[model samples]
Structures are given as structure tokens and as C-alpha cells.
Target: MNTLFMHCRPGFEGEVCSEISDHAARLNVAGYAKAKPQSACAEFICHEPEGPQRLMRELRFAELIFPRQWARGEFVPLPESDRIGVLLEHLSNLPTCSSVWLEVLDTNDGKELSTFCRKFEVPLRKALIKAGKLQEDGNGPRLLLTFKSGREVFVGLADADNSAMWPMGIPRLKFPREAPSRSTLKLEEAWHHFIPRDQWDARLNGDMTGVDLGAAPGGWTYQLVRRGMLVTAIDNGPMAESLMDTGLVQHLMADGFTFKPKQTVDWMVCDIVEKPARNAALLETWLGEGLCREAVVNLKLPMKQRYAEVRRLLDRIADGFKARGVKVSIGCKQLYHDREEVTCHLRRLDMKPRPSH
Candidate 1:
């Protein structure tokens, strides 16, 4: 076996390598990961022959903390001249695939490779169709070809249902001028990432009520209001006059850490600037005490050991919920709009069987 490659936020390659190494070991699949800081990618090679298939079966992409995109494949090196012929020759040997996506590392040089990919896709598609390898309507494996340069590439296959829809795991969203701050995009992105699109209208019902802790200027509250939710915006500072004018928001001049809703609400959102552990504790209190049905919170990270801190905070939250005999659905992500922080969504599952994993 060649290797399983994963792309992540540049400079966090070490964290991805560490996590994948642990997961591989946990599954009793021996492997070693090679990662370099700022490389934007990592590769894991297994000592066992069936490790790649085992990894695909055992690990879900959403559970990973650092890796944004991944594939199980071997590297393919193309010849300098007559590159199309070399690409076609390699394609002829692989299993039939229905779709294809060309990727590159998230780096300065890697960005420039997109132009070449755009030009190459046309002829590649034609060749694939002519060779009877591109099934138009069939549900088959997706071919992910990651270009390191013009001549160097990695050819991988991952199930379409299990992979990300975006090319580099980045979603394209337009900022609404009505929102007071760009931070509104963070919540929008978080919703898109955690909540499946088919269930959005149901999850964001019009009659929902929510409280926005640290909701100065109403950036996050704007999203809640858009869903027709009555929101209590908590903060000591002044909020955007435009948001208050809508009559859907009530601004409270109170500290977020000490404030509590008068009754249980549908949602609780927090964007306070504090240590990761403190923010985690606040979420724990809200969900554990049954103050809200669901909550979205952001935790700022330190420069060193960012992954470790996230794990510790999540563990604390999980422990608290377990002690209270509650089952909580917890999700976390480092959104494109975030800087040195990760957003988390926690929802209480009172009537459902708690997941052991």
C-alpha cells in the first residue's frame, strides 16, 4: 500500500498526523504518519495490508478535528512532456469512476496550479468518457486527483457520500449587508457545517426562542432573527440600533457569564472572549441545567497545544453531561471565518438512547 493522504489547515499538519496515528493504532492497524508544519498535508502508511479499508470503515470524516479533507490513494508521477498521454495511461488502469475533482495543497504555489487543472479537465473528461470509465448516471467511486505540481499527483478514491462537497473543504457564502458585522458569517457557516441542509427549515422553525450571550452589535443574533426567533441579546455594551428596531430583539445590559434565562428556550448562543475551559463550562451549565434545548458557543485557543485544549474542554463538557444523566449531541468546527477559535454546537437528546461512542 502507498499511503492515505489528508489535507488540513496549513501549520496544523502535526496535529492531524498525531490524531490519525492514534486512530490507526486504536484500530490495531499499524501505521506511521509523516507531517511537516505549513505543508498543508500529511501522509500515513500502514504496516498492515488491510489498513486503508479498515480506516475507511472505522473513521468518519466529521469526527476528525484538524483534517479538512482526505483520500485513500497512491501517488502518481506524470512525465514532463506529453502529460495528457501519461495521465490517460494511468487513468486506464483504475476502476471506473463517475465523477472527478482536482485538488492541490492550500499553499501559495498550490493555488497557481488551479489554472493548469482547469485546462486539463476538459481533455481528461473526454478521454475518460471515450474509455468507458466515466459512468454518467451510475453511483460509483469518485476520483480525487491531488496535484502537488504539474508532474506530481496523487490519485485517490473515496465514496461520494463520505467526502466533502467542496474542493478544498471551503464553503462559498455571500455576506448579507443587513448583518451588523462579518462575524455573522461564522454562525451561518457553522449552521451549514453542522446542520444538514434538508433539515434546516425544520431545525430553524419560526416560533423558536433563543438567547445570545455576549451579543453586542447583534452579529449572531441577526441570524437568529432571520429565522424569526425571539432573541434576548445579553451584553453590557450597546447593540446595533438596526437590530433592535426590528422589535425581535431585547438587549440586556448584563454579564454573559452570570446571566441566566428566565425559562428554558429553544437555543442559547455564546461568543464571549474567554479561555476555552471557561466557555466549555458555560455550555455545560446551560445544557446540564436544561436551560436550553441547544447551544452554539465559540472558544478561543492559545498558540501552543491548541488541539490538546479543545480535547480537554470537550472532555469536561462530556463528563458533566454524563454526570447529570443527560445525552448531548456535541459538534465542533474551525470555520473559515474563525481565527484562533473553534465554534461548537451542543443539543440535548433527552428521549433518545445515548451513544456509547
Candidate 2:
């Protein structure tokens, strides 16, 4: 009950630990994180018995950039002969779970356990239901059983509204065959992660216009084009011929960092290869100057202090917007399709005039 378990990219365990430590300290929940490099998971053990419970109530999972999914619980050993029996015995103490997710780490060893988890799920689910510990109440908490091995698993609970919708926080997306490059998934995932589905028709409608910096081959531009938006593709390199055939694109050869549009557009997206701080600055300039109403950008991370750098860059952007007397909503995440980088979504809100000084 005093531990929080988190799932992340295989090599990003350190980043998760750093982020959790910072967040926990901010909430005055004295705790320490334990993680192994490349383990794909981390745990924060609270000094006080009730610390994790308080964190689960106050911490917003979507605000955490590194951890894909999180749960509050402790590990329990199971006898190989009666794994389900042991789990049922322990689950008797928990509230009725709405559903159960049997998860594994995203690693080679984790992959090897997938078949076992699948086979174990059917029977375990039935057992839980028969024992009256599982129900279909939509408001009930989700049971998270993360299997570390055949003999050990982490039993935990996650609030559906506060946690990722997908198991292990990994969305299952198949690459569209018509897409020019696999990179298209990055933008797609960003939209899913940042924008609510109900608001898409209003915010990402067909009547909108967009600009894609470094739009070579149109990997990112493809998303906008398919959604029926007119796009200005800026890149010195060539764009995909298929995207050009759409008759909705205006391709330009120019420097993404220096190019300025004649008029503000509805959206601006950048996936340029550049330093993290530099990319953050570019996004700030766009939103601050009223260049675009909304933006999606990827910041390539450095090898060290990745979490610290992300926070600094985001804070800088927020401070810049405040100085300019503009209101904006910012969201950042290390998307499933992203590697060594994080995706950011910035949306300009209605301007609130500053009071007389």
C-alpha cells in the first residue's frame, strides 16, 4: 500500500525514477524510488504507510511524462502450482474491481511471458468473478496485475479516470500501409494522447490549415492531409508524391527555424532534428507571436539528465507565454512511437487581458 509501481520505456527507468521523486517531494509525500537501468519499470516506496494513497488521489497520471502507466500496490509471491489461488486470496482484501489487466514489461523477458499471461487471464478472471471480487461497475477501480515472473507479480489498483486507457499505457496501433513513413504514427499518437476524441471535429476539422516544418517525405503532413486540412509543407528536401497529389498541400523550400508564415494558421507541427532547447524555443516563438493556434513538436533528448531538461524547457515555454500575456495549454509525453525524444502539444487559449499595473 506504500509503493507506487510505474511502467516506462525499457531504457528510461532512470527518467521515471527522477520524475516520480520530484513529484512526490512536491506533494510532501516522503518517498524514495528504486529502479534498474533498462528494466522498463520502477517503484517508489513511501516513508509513510499512507503516502501512496494520497499520491494516487492527488497526482494526475496524464501529467507524468515518463511513466506510461502506474499502479499502487506491492509484490506478492505465488506458488507455481496455485498462482490463481494465491491471487484470489490476496484480492479478497481489495474493493470490487471493474476489470483486470494482466500486464508485462516491454522487454525480451516480458515478451516471453506474454503467452503465459494470456493463458493465465481466462481462468484468473473467472476465479475473481466467482469470488465476488470482480464486477462490471463502470466507476470501480481497475485491478492491475503486473507479472514479473511465474513466481512473482505486483498486485495493484488504478483509477480508470486517472490512468491511461490502454494496458501498460501502450496503445496498439498498426502502421497504415498508405503512410509514407513509420514516423506518421508519432503524430497520430500525439493527437490521441493530447486531444480528447469528442473535441476532434471542432479543433481538427476539415476547414483548418496547417504548416509542417521539416516536412520532407510528408510523414507528419500525411496526418493533416488525410484529415482534410490544407497544409503548407516546409522543407528543403522533397515531399512524398502521394501527398502532393492531394492538391491540398503547398510545398516550400525554406529553413524551418527562420521561415515565417504571412498569416497565422490553425495548426503548426514540427519534427525537425534539433536540440531539445532549440525546438522548445521555436515552439515558444510560434505561440507567443500568435503564429498558430495550436502546435505539435518533437524535442530530441540529450544523453543525460533527460527529465531535468524536459522540465526546464517546458517551464521556459510557460514563462514565455506568461510574459507575453497569452494563455496556453501545454501537454508533453514520451509517446510510444517516439525514441530518444518527447512529443509536445501546445494550444493557445482565449487571451485574458492583464490587469492595469
Candidate 3:
């Protein structure tokens, strides 16, 4: 296949296109991206036949901010009389896949295809297994059947390790009824996206401490409290009484930008409404000063050139840390629960003392 198909939030197709095009150029892959406004997806068509495979091999999906999920392949036209037969014939020429995901876009039209996709999955799975094209070999790629319409589908393959674990790159998280605000899902999803689940027990345990900026109503703080972490909720507004009742939170009336922890904390999370650059600088100060071992902060995007703005802010953070001789692992994502903002995770790796002149 010569195309890389990507699924993103509707209205963000332009960002996805911009991002993929930049990556392709950096990797020396000759390609151009195409996206329709609010289509909820984009495609990168490569000049070379092997361009898609090369990009897939070199690109790190976790580092990509806009695309929720992506696959590499070409669109296939299906006959109404025997769609499964046509797909099976095409599959026979490809390698065995570990699993199959029948997907649709995240738009209304895509929603309409959900029932058809669900009904088509079982029969497709059976047919693939019978044809020896689908097997759980642990190392095989995932088969992605993305339906654009009843007669058109993109037959793609995605490396399980390099793609989003969830279908369409969206995690289904239910909002807690007790959460003071629905914004709680943002932090919950951030953890799922940034922190590896295998390390959660050790790194995100009850013994750890956290700080939540803009903590009024305790949406973000609630996540820390529920995880059994003692938290200092910093804000000039009232926090949720339910959170205070947990005895896990200490509310402080102060400005998030000026507040500093009494001691180094395990985590610092912020969801404050502020300029993207200002928020990033705040995160830099906390990390550069060794105030927190890890942090999850939200950066509200501007009305235009959001991709460029995000890149500039992130680069500024990296440069700031480098100048301070601090090593950190950073990751950013436009999470499912986020709107006009992206969440960033920064983990302190280690620090090297500067040599005296």
C-alpha cells in the first residue's frame, strides 16, 4: 500500500495533515497529505510504493499529537453481492494478522456505519480464520478494515506495538458521578496515554504525593485522591467538599503560577485556563527546579496555527530543561476528553551537576 490512513478528532484533520507531511519530509519520504475539513480522518499518499511501510517503521505513534490511530494500506472497492469474498481474495495475498478491527470514522456518517461494521465483523473474522489469514501469533500485524461506505473500505495493516491499543484511538472512559466536573476524565485519560499500565502500581501508588493547580472543584485532584495519593490542591477558589472529606487533599488558596510545593512532589497536574506558552513555562519551572518527579499539564491552544504553537512551546520546554542540565521524558497528546487543549506529561529522568568554571 502507498497510503497512510489516520483517524483524528473531527475538525483536526488539518493538524493531522500538517503533522504527517512534516514527518514524511523529515524521514525523506516523498508524500503529500490530504484532508477534508471535519472529515475526522486524513491520508498521506507516498510517491514511492514503499513509502508507507518506511514511514510506519520509523514513525513513533506515541509521539504523534494529532492522529489517534493510523494504518497503512489502500482503499478497496467491494461488490455488494459478496463483500466478504472480495476481502478474502485480497487478504490471501497478505501476511497473517494477529487480529482484525472493523473501524469507522468518528463523524456522524461514520456513526451510521457502526451497526454495519459490527454485523460484518463476525463473518469477516470467521472467513479470515478459515482462509488462514488471521491468527494470533503474538507478533503479527493487526488487520484494519476501515469502512468509508458500504461499498468502499480501506484494507490496512498496523503494527500492534506501534499503534494505539484502542480502536479509532479513542479510549472509552466513563465519567464518575461523584467527580465535581466532567474534566476529571482528562487526567484519567492522560494517565492511560502517558503512563505505562505495568508501572502504575509502583509509580502511582498511595505513598506518592501530588499537587493540582487550578484545583477548584477538584476535577484533576479527584484523580489523585482516588488513587490514594495525598494532594495539595492549589487554587483561589473552593474545592469540592467531597474531596476534602477524603482527607487526602489539602486546599491552598493561591495562584497556580506562583505556588510552589513545600517539598518535591511525586506528581504535579494543572488544567488551568491560561496561554499555552505561559502554562508551558510554569511546567518548565517545576521540572527544572526538581520540584516534581512527574507532571501532567494542559496547554490551551490558540485560535490558529495550533500545531505550530504546540511545537514551539514544547521545544521551549526541552531547551529550558537542557540548559538546566535536567533530563526528562516528555509526551503530549490531544486526548479524547480534551477540547481546544492538549495534555502533556513530563517525567524527570536524572540531573547532571554543571561543572564549576
Candidate 4:
């Protein structure tokens, strides 16, 4: 595998390319990136003979802001009649895979190929099993087969622990019918992405306290309340009657940025539509001042220099906490449910603020 492929949100290829280019340079590997904006895909053409393996080993998928899913593999143009045979040849080149995911780009043409991919999967799985390329015992890497079209595909592999939890980094979580709005999915996705699943129940215990800044209509608040948290919903606008009816939420008519909690809470969640820098500072303040143990906030992005802007804001937050002698865990992700925004999660490890970067 000589070329690296990544799947990002449409219109974000430039940011994706910039991120990979910087990352590759940091790894002391040279590569050139090419991307078609809004195509939802990008390619990193590596100059080194062994760069792909090293890149895969060095870069942790969770830390990448732009790419939803990525793979390092060569493109194989399948001949019409011998498509299966050609794919088998590629599979033989890779280590045995525990499972296979036949994916396509998030584009109109990609949607059109889904039916064909579904049909192709069954026979391909059988062939792989017969050829000793697929393992049923979950001891091998997972194969990622991203189809650019019916005639072309990128064959790649990723370790389960270091890769996205879902195929193409898109989680298939259904919107709860009882939830107030579809925006609820964004918060749910953020928790899944930033927090390990095994710690969820323990982390979000019953009667945990949380404050939802800009909590009008209660999308994020709904998620916290569902976890049995008592919520202080701050917003100038009215909250949903359904949410208020639950009695778990206290709708405070106040501004998110100006309001400060009278007491420390377990979590502070914000979905305020504001500039990324302001939101980033808000998160830094909350963690720095010992106001909350954990926080999840949304940073709506700008049209240009999106990736650079995100990196700057994140750095400021880290530097501010370091200056304040704080120990914290921070994570950022662009979720499937988010539009023009990225979600950030911060957890303060020190009960009382102490300096440690």
C-alpha cells in the first residue's frame, strides 16, 4: 500500500489534506496530498517505500480531526469479468482479516453502488474464508474495502483498537422517538466518540448534575437527563414543554457565556451556535476554574481555513490550562450529526486545579 485514502465530510478535502500533510511531516515522512473538495475523499501519495506502515503505526485515528475513516492502500482497477479474482489477489497481499467492510464514499454515486456492494459482499466473504484470508475468531486486522466506483476500490487494513468504532466512522444510532429534537443525536454521538463505552454507566451515574448552556428545546439536555442527571438549562429562549414537563430540567433564562454555576457540577454541555474561538475559551475557563468535572461543547466552524482555526483554538485551550496548572483530558471530533461544527469534550482530572500540562 503506497497511497493513503481518507474519507472526510464533503467540502472538507482541503482541510483533510492539510491535516495529513502536517501529520506526515511530523512523522518525518514525506507525502503529497490531492483532494477534490466536496468529493468526500482525499489521497496522500507517499514518497517513501515503507511510509504507509509507519504512518499507520504512528498516527492514532482518534486524534485526527478531519478524517472520519482512513486507509493506506493501493488502488486496483478491477477488470470486468475477473473482479472477484482480482480482489482475492489483493486480499492475499494483506494479513488475514477478522472481518470485511465494503464501503463507498458519501456521495450520490457512492449511494448508487450500495446495492452492488451488498450483493458482492456475500460471495467475497465466502471466497476469503475459503482462501484463508478471513478469520472468524477475531484475531486479525479488519479489511476496509472503500469503493470509489464499481470499477475501482482501495484495499486497506486497520487494527480494531486504533480505528473508528463504526464503518466509515459513521455510527448507526437511531434517534429516540421520545427525544425532543433530532439534534439529540449529535450529543449522543459525541459521548460515544469521546468516552469509552465501558465507562459510560459509571461516568454518567444516576442523579449526576449537569448544566446545558444554550439549552433551548433541550437536545443536549435531553441526553443528560436521560442519563438521570439533574440539569440546569441556560438559555434566553424557551425550552420544550415536553422537556420542562420531565421535571429533571431547570430552565434558566440566562446567557451561556455570562452565566456561572453557583456550585460545581458533574458535566457542562453546550450546543451554542457561536464562533469557534469563543466556545474554545468558554471550555478553557470552565476547566481552568474548577467549575465542572467534564464538559462537552460545540464549535461551529467558518467557511475558510477550518482545520487551522480548529487547531488554533484547541491549542489555546491546552495552553491556558497548562498555564493554570491543570490536568485535563480533551478530545475533538466532527460527528456525522454535526453540520459546520466540531464537538469537543474536556475532563478535568484534578479536583482542585493544579498545574500539569
117-179 per-residue lDDT for model 1 (tens digits): 999888888887888778867787888888999989988877777766577677788999999
Candidate 4: count of backbone clashes, pairs at least 3 residues apart or interchain: 3
Candidate 2 structure quality by residue, lDDT tens digits, 1-357: 889999999899999999999989899999899999889999999999788888889888998899999999989998969888888889878899999999999989999998999999999989988998889765689999999998899999999889887999999988988888999999989999999889787778778889999999999999999889999999999999999999999999999999989988889999999998889999999999988989999999999999999999999999999999999999999988899999999998974322221
TM per candidate: 0.93, 0.97, 0.97, 0.96
> Comparing candidate 1 with candidate 2, which one achieves the higher lDDT?
2
Question: Which residue pairs show collisions in model 2?
Answer: none
Q: For model 4, how big is the CA root-mean-square deviation?
A: 3.0
Residues 69-121 of candidate 3 have per-residue lDDT tens digits of 99999999998879999998888778999999999999999999999999989
lDDT (Cα atoms) of all candidates against the true structure: 0.84, 0.91, 0.92, 0.88
Off by over 4 Å in 1: 351-357
Q: In candidate 4, list every pair of residues with a backbone clash.
A: 11-38, 325-354, 325-355
TM-score of 2: 0.97
Candidate 3: misplaced stretches above 4 Å? 351-357
Candidate 4: worst-modelled 10 consecutive residues by lDDT:
348-357
For each candidate in turn, give its C-alpha RMSD to the true structure in angstroms: 3.5, 3.6, 3.6, 3.0
